[model samples]
Target: MDRPHWSVPLALVWVSSFFLHFAWEMWQVVFYEGMATASHAAAIWICTKATFGDANIALAAYLAAALSVCSIDWVRTPTGTPLFFYLAAGLLITVLFEYLATEVLGRWEYNEQMPTLPLLGTGLLPLAQWIVVPLVSLYATRLMYFGFLPMREYAANKPA
Candidate 1:
């Protein structure tokens, strides 16, 4: 089989990551921040888009890490990374983004409403949000593209 091109898969992953992260961030903000007021539609939309930007930053970080690894011996292609390594790269990248965005850049703030880890001083929801949503998105994308899940196979060979 020919090696798969990196562009399409990377685009798909980028979009999937954006939406997945946006949805999870929206959920957390609504439930925890009490920002679900009917009048807050515009605010909700803005917040959702901000999270989308965050997701895009994460995708860039992941792709950078993947390309860096691809330059190494074992992983030769950008898309050839193992899932575990991909996830680990994303986690580390996102943690750094979170720290810089919250602590350094003052882009956003987390209140007492968010569950904080002792040493990290960061919310658990945001940290876990990257993990759960991206993994599910990747799994679903794999199932769709690779036919990994069990399903009825239609036979083209058998004809009446």
Candidate 2:
């Protein structure tokens, strides 16, 4: 079946998100590089260390929350949400889910290298992923799947 044209706003959201994935990868590179510079071998260890224990658990919890929200298609407008607001909401949702799941789900626990006032204070890495990438990714995926936009159009129309 053929797909109809996407509303321009949805196209912008989709295109922006496509670029944002690259942006996140760049950030991750910076993070990993920073870790490496501290000491190459030690950086690898530290990076792995970052994912250790309950931190992994908390990270998983964050992904679940973000996935749940993303799955909803509840984003009200397919075009966009206020930029800062959407990101902030995504952050809140990720943090809340990680918090509640650790407190309630018991499916996992946080890998806190050192426990702090906040259960997994260092778990910010995972939370950031959920907020910045996955939420927009979800939006982009829906835009394509629902025929608000389609990959074939994208492929053909991509600038030469």
Per-prediction CA RMSD (Å): 6.9, 10.7
Q: Relative to the true structure, how large is the alpha-carbon lDDT of every model?
A: 0.61, 0.46
Model 2, residue 104: displacement in angstroms? 2.4
With candidate 1 superimposed using the best TM-score fit, by how many Å does residue 22's alpha carbon deviate from the native?
A: 1.7
Give the per-residue lDDT digits (tens) of candidate 1, residues 64-133: 6566566321122224455556667767767776678777897666766777668766678877876787
TM for every model, in the order presented, reads: 0.68, 0.34
What are the clash counts of all predictions, listed in order?
0, 4
Q: Candidate 2: list runs displaced more than 4 Å.
A: 1-81, 113-122, 134-160
Q: Candidate 2 local accuracy as lDDT?
A: 0.46
